[model samples]
Target: MERQVSNRYRLIEPLGEGGMGVVWRAYDELLDRTVAIKEVRYTGVGDDKRADLNRRTIREARAAGRLDHPSVIVIHDVVEEDGRPWIVMQLIRSRSLAEVIREHGPLPVAQAALIGGRVLDALRAAHATGVLHRDVKPENVLLADDGRVVLTDFGIASLEAEAGLTATGGLVGTPAYMPPERLNGEPARPESDLWSLGATLYAAVEGVPPFKRDSWAATVAAVLRDLPGQPVRAGVLGPVIMGLLQRDPAARMSADEAAHLLRAAASEPAPYGYAAPPAPPPGPAGSWSDMTGPGERGPAGTVSLRARRRGWFLGVPAAVLAVAALGTGGWYVVTTSQSATTPTPAPTSTSTPAPSRATASPTATPEASTTPTTPRLPAGWRRLANSAGQFSIGIPQGWQAKKSPTRDSITVTGPGTPGMLLVEWTVPDKPVADPARAWVELEKEIQAKGEFAGYERIGIRSTTYLGRPAADWEFTRQRGGTLIHVINRGFRTADGRHYALYWDTTDARWDQDRHYFDQFVKTFRPE
Candidate 1:
C-alpha cells in the first residue's frame, strides 16, 4: 500500500532516515513528477514546543526554497499532513561523498579539491542569503550521476533573521566537523561553516574526519582541545584545510581566500610529489591561460617524455604508474627479440614487477578481435584484448602494450617515437555526465598547475561518438625539446561504462600517423 501526503505527494519508498526525519522517494500527483519528501517528526515534546518546532521547520524550508544556486538543492514545497511537516525537494540520483570515499578509499587530491570547491560555492551562496547550513559534512554532499556536486540536508539550517531555534546547551552539528567556537556554545557564524568545509575536505582526501573519536563527547573534546592530525594526502589542499580548521574563527581563512586557494588546488596536475604553481594573478574568471609566462614550466619546471606520461596518468583516476621507477633505457626498449607470449597474470596489491620491464604479449590472440557488428581493423593493425582491464583495442603492428599495475589501463608504445596511445577505463562510481565541461575544468587545472611545458590548446568541444555523448580535447606540448600533438576522446557507453582513448605523436608526424587514432577507435570494443 502507498502513503499519500496532503493528497498530492504519494510516498514511493524511503530513501534515507535520520534521527529526526525520514526522506522518501515520492511522486507529486499534481505536478506528475518525482520528488523527495522529508517527513520531519518530533517526539517527547510538549504541545507548545511541538508547535514551535513545526513553525521553525516551515520557516527553514521556506528559507532554503529561496536559495538559488546550482550547487544547492532545490526545495519544492512544504506540506502539512498528519500534524507534521513534509518538506519536498529535488530528487537527485546520486551517492553521498561519504559513500564514495568508503568504496574507493581516499580521493585524489585534485578530485578532493574540485568537490570541495563546489561544496564551498553552495555554502557561500547560502551565507549570502543569511541561511547558515548548521551541518556541512561528507554525508550531506552528494556526487550526482549527472556530474553535480550538491550540498543538501539543510533541515537544521539556522536563519540569521530568526531567533535561536535550538535548545540551550544543545549542539546541532556533528561533533567531528563542528568548529571549536560552536562547541564552546558560540553562535553559528559563516566562518564556522568554512571550518566544517575544511573538515569535510580533510575526510575526502584522508578518508576520515580530522577530529573523529570513539565517542561523541570525546570528539567534541578533541575538536575543542586537540589540533587535527596532519593530512598526508592533501597535497596542494593541505594549507587550505589547515587554515580553515583554525580554532579561532577570526583567524581562519576568509571565504574569498579559501575559494581562490581551492580553485588553484583543483587545477593542480598531480596530488603528490609536486608543489602547485602560485595562484594565477587575479583576472576575469576562466582566464587560466594568462597565468604562465613564456618558458615558465610546471612545478618541476621541465617536461621529459616520462614526466609527460606521469602527468597524463595523474590527471586520471586510480593511476598507479610508477614512472620514476622505470629507468630511461628500460622504458624505450623494443622487445623485438621476444617471441609470442601468453598473457601475464594481473598484478595484485603486493605484486612488484621487475625493475627493468613489465611483461606484455607481442600480439593479440584470435578472441581479441572486435565484434562483427563493429568495423574490422586495417590489415596492419591487430585488436588486442586485455583481460585484466576488460577492453580490447586495435594497435599498429610494431607497438607493444603494457598494462598498468592496477589493471585499469593499457599503454601502447612503438619503436622510435616518444609518443604513445593510452586507453584507460578506471571509472569511478559516479561517472562524468558532461565530458566537454569536464575537459574544460581539467584544462584549467592543468594550465593553472603548469603541468605542460610550452602548453597550447587547440580546443575542447562536445560531440557524439558511436551514438553516445562524447567530448574531444586536443592540444600540443613540448616534450624533451620536441613538439608533441595530442588528442583525447572520452565517452560513456549506453550500458554506463566510461572509457578514454588518448593518442599522442610528434608534431611533425601528426598528420602522417593521425589515421592510427581512427583505426584504433573503429576497432575498439569494451567487454
Candidate 2:
C-alpha cells in the first residue's frame, strides 16, 4: 500500500482506531507540519452501501471542518485518495477523559465541572456551525497537555441538511450514552447530545455511568426506567447533572442553563443534602410525546424518552428492525423484542396459491374475522395502484402510497402508525431460489447485530403463495420499552424473481393492523 497520501501527507505512526476509520499522526510535507489524518476505509461494503458511506464521510469532514473553536479540533484538509476520505486535522497531544477515569477514578466535582464547561463551549461552537457531534463520550473528550480541552470524532455527526447514514437504518451511536428516543429509532438532536454530555459528566463524577448494566438489553432498560442515583460524590454539581440528564429532551436543561450551571459548579464548594430524583412509576417504559397534527410531521427524535441511553461504536449497515425496511424485500423484514432465548415457532400452515388479482373494496368492513385465513380490510380503506403498474393493493385511509424510483417497490405509510406496507419484486434471468431460507438468513444477521431488545421471532415457515414458492415470518421488537410487530410474506414468481408483501405496526395495534394487512395481501395483484 502507498504511504504518501494526496502526494503530500506522509503516514507516520498511528494514533487510534475507531468504527468509522483510523486516526494517524502524520506529517504534512507540503505544509511542513505534523497533522492528524483520519482515514475512512469501506472495505467489503456493497455498491449500494458504499455510496452512502462516502456521502456520510464527506459530510462528517465538512461538519467538523466548519467549526472554528479552540476546544474543537481544527481540520487542516480533506482529500479523497483511493476512493477513501482522508481528513487531515490538528494534532493535539492529550489523554482521553476515559483514560483519566480508568487511571485515577472519577474526577473531583470542581474539575469535572471545569472539563464539562470547556466541552460545552466546543458544543456551542459546533451547534452554531450547524454541526451535531452525534458521538459525544468521555473517549472523545481530549485533555491537552498544554491546558486545553477539545471535542473529537464527529464520525456519526449530523448536519442541518444531511440525513445521518443510520437515520432510517438500525440504531447508531453508543447505546449506553445514546438518548432514549434515538434508541427507539428517533433522529439525533442537539438535546440528545446534551443527554450524552450529562452521562459523560456523571461518569466523571461517579466513576460509573448512572445506567451501567451487564448487557445491552439491561442497560437500555435501566436508562428507560431508573433515574440516576443522586450523585453522592457530585456535591454542588449533582443537580446540574440531573437537570442535563432529563429523560425528555423538551424538558431537559437548555444549553444556556446547563452552561451557566456548569460554570457555577466549577467554582462552588460542596453543598450538603443531595435530593434523589423520584423513581418512575412502573408501567410502559416508553410514553408517546410530541403528538403530530394532521398533515404536519415531526423529526425522528420525537420518539425519545428522557434517559440518556448510550452505546459504543457499532459499524452496522442499513438494517430494517421495526419493519421490513431491509434488503429491497424478498425476506429481510422483521420486528424485535427482548428475550433471553429464541422461542420455537409453531407448526407450519399448508400451502395455497393466491390469485394474481383479487377484488379490493375501500371499506373497513370486518367480513371475515372468525378465522385469520380470510382477512378483512379496515373501514374507509382505498385501493392504491403503483405508478409503475407492477402491482396494486388496498391501503387504509390516510395511508400514502409512494413508488420507489427503481420501479420495483412501493411503501404505504400513514400518520397515525409507525409501521408501513412494503412491496418488493424483481424480474429474473435465473431460476428462483428458496424463499423460506431468506428469512432464516435475515434472522441470523439480525441476531448477529445483537443490539436489540425484545427481539423475539413470533413465527416463520415455508408456505405457498400465488402459485409459487413462498415463505412467511412474524416477529416483535420492543426497543426502549416500546413494542412493534412485523409480518412478511415472500414468494418466487414464474419469472424467477421474488416478491414480498411486508407489514409492520405497533404491537398494541397489531390485532387491528393485521386485518388491514390481510385485505391487502388477499387483493394484491402482480401485473
Number of clashes in every candidate structure? Answer: 1, 31
* Candidate 2 global CA lDDT score: 0.60
Best by lDDT: 1
In order of appearance, the predictions have TM-scores of 0.56, 0.50
Which sections of candidate 2 miss by over 4 Å?
164-168, 269-527
lDDT of 1: 0.65
Worst 10 residues of 1 by lDDT: 332-341
lDDT of residue 156 for candidate 2: 66
Model 1 C-alpha lDDT per residue in residues 1-527, reported as the tens digit of each score: 89899899999878787777888888898988778889999888778888888888888889988886656788989988888889999886667888778767898775677678778877887888899998999989876533346788888887988847655345668999999998898788899999999999999999999999999999989998999999999988999999999999999999899988886675454323111112212222111111122332222100000111222222332211112113432221100000011112221111111111222221212122222464455665556665433455666667777655322356778876666777755323222224555565556655776767887776665554545445566777886677888777665443333467777888898877776677677767655
Model 2 residue 474 distance off true place after TM-score fit, in angstroms: 77
Collision pairs in model 1: 267-445
Quantify how close model 2 is to the true structure by its C-alpha RMSD in Å: 25.2
How would you encode candidate 2's per-residue C-alpha lDDT over 370-393 as one tens digit per residue?
112322334565544442334446
Q: What lDDT does each candidate get?
A: 0.65, 0.60
